[model samples]
Target: MDCKSESGLEMQNVCIVEDDDAVRDALAELVESDGYRVLSYASAEEFVAGADATQVDVLIVDFRLPGMSGGELLKRLNERGMRLPVILMTGHADCDEVGLGLDVQDVSFLTKPCDPRRLLGLIGAAVDGKG
Candidate 1:
């Protein structure tokens, strides 16, 4: 799970935006274990304020956040010309509900309680530009 390049620098960055502390921590741990650098935030606003979208390889976000829904965040990113691979995870909503205002490419949806292996696979595929 060493995702560093030949020079020993991390090659992939994964950002997780989830409002729940437990979920965010668990996701960060999972993604980090797979060798990707993980930066997590409790909400989309926090992510927007702290993260540099250009450095992100993949974004895993919750559909409903405390401030600025995941779909709106993606829209803003898209408007800024930052089209990164995104995985939208939700516990109560489906794609139709979450994608209402979303307009971006290289995006996928995963329901809550998503299989860890599937998430890892999606992250790998996203980093490889095949997801």
Candidate 2:
């Protein structure tokens, strides 16, 4: 069977839930450059409503959001049984506290203004189900 989707998109897709347009676009560009499909959302609600859990290989979310935070979103995804790998980005000094007990698997945190290489590496790891 072919791995690509019916739309001819790559099989591996990364869902980015970020409210910041600049940050979201930059992440999407970087992810796409690595040959993976990118699905970006302005809010966790939008992501949850629009994204297909089965199609997403990994999730990249911002710690702070307009309504539901990244941790809350992670919990929501878990409740839906979509245990995709996750990466959380934030500028909050206590971002770790916000994500203390998320129920998802293979989760990692990235501080805001994260190094491009680090972000790429983290995404690569998540895609491979390692981190």
Candidate 3:
């Protein structure tokens, strides 16, 4: 389903699910600047309850959230038959531990204080069905 933005450009809708207000805002701004429409959420549960879930082309989630973890959210989405691409972000230095929590085949895991360019690249890959 191709979605057109008000600017007349093909816009990919991305959902940013993070508990931290600053991180969410920053991520939203960055993604928007990259020409994608972003919907920022405070938690996985909040995103799950919102209508934007079905409309997003990709989901950018934090590994640890207040209500539900990113992995758990992925599990729930899978069970519900939603095939949205997800990217996990974490502040932890242990990639192995993060790997253990994520079981999805195409998930992209990035460390916290993520580089904006790298995040944009990952998001493009995800939206292009390459992640």
Error of 1 at 27 (Å): 0.6
> Model 2, 12-130: lDDT tens per residue?
77889999999999999998898777888999999878878777787899989999988888887788777788888878585647656674456888888888899889888877763
What candidate 1 gets wrong by more than 4 Å, as runs, is 1-7
TM-score on alpha carbons, each prediction: 0.88, 0.86, 0.86
Q: How do the residues 1-131 of candidate 1 rate in per-residue lDDT, one tens digit apiece? A: 34467878767989999999999999999998998888889999999999888778899999888779888888888888888899999866456677665755678889989999999999999988833
Instruction: Quantify all predictions' global Cα lDDT against the true fold.
Output: 0.86, 0.82, 0.81
CA RMSD of each candidate after superposition: 3.2, 3.1, 2.5
Give the Cα-based TM-score of candidate 2 against the true structure.
Answer: 0.86
- Candidate with the greatest TM-score versus the true structure: 1
Q: Write the per-residue lDDT of candidate 3 for residues 1-131, one digit (tens) a residue.
A: 34687778778898899998888988999999988888888988888888455677889999888878887888788777777788889877546566763465368888988788999999998888732
Candidate number achieving the greatest lDDT relative to the actual structure: 1
Give candidate 3 misplaced runs (Cα > 4 Å): 93-97
Pairs with backbone N, CA or C atoms under 3 Å apart (clashes), candidate 2 = none
Q: How does residue 48 of candidate 3 score in lDDT? A: 83
Q: After superposition, how far is residue 130 of candidate 3 from its true place, in Å?
A: 6.7
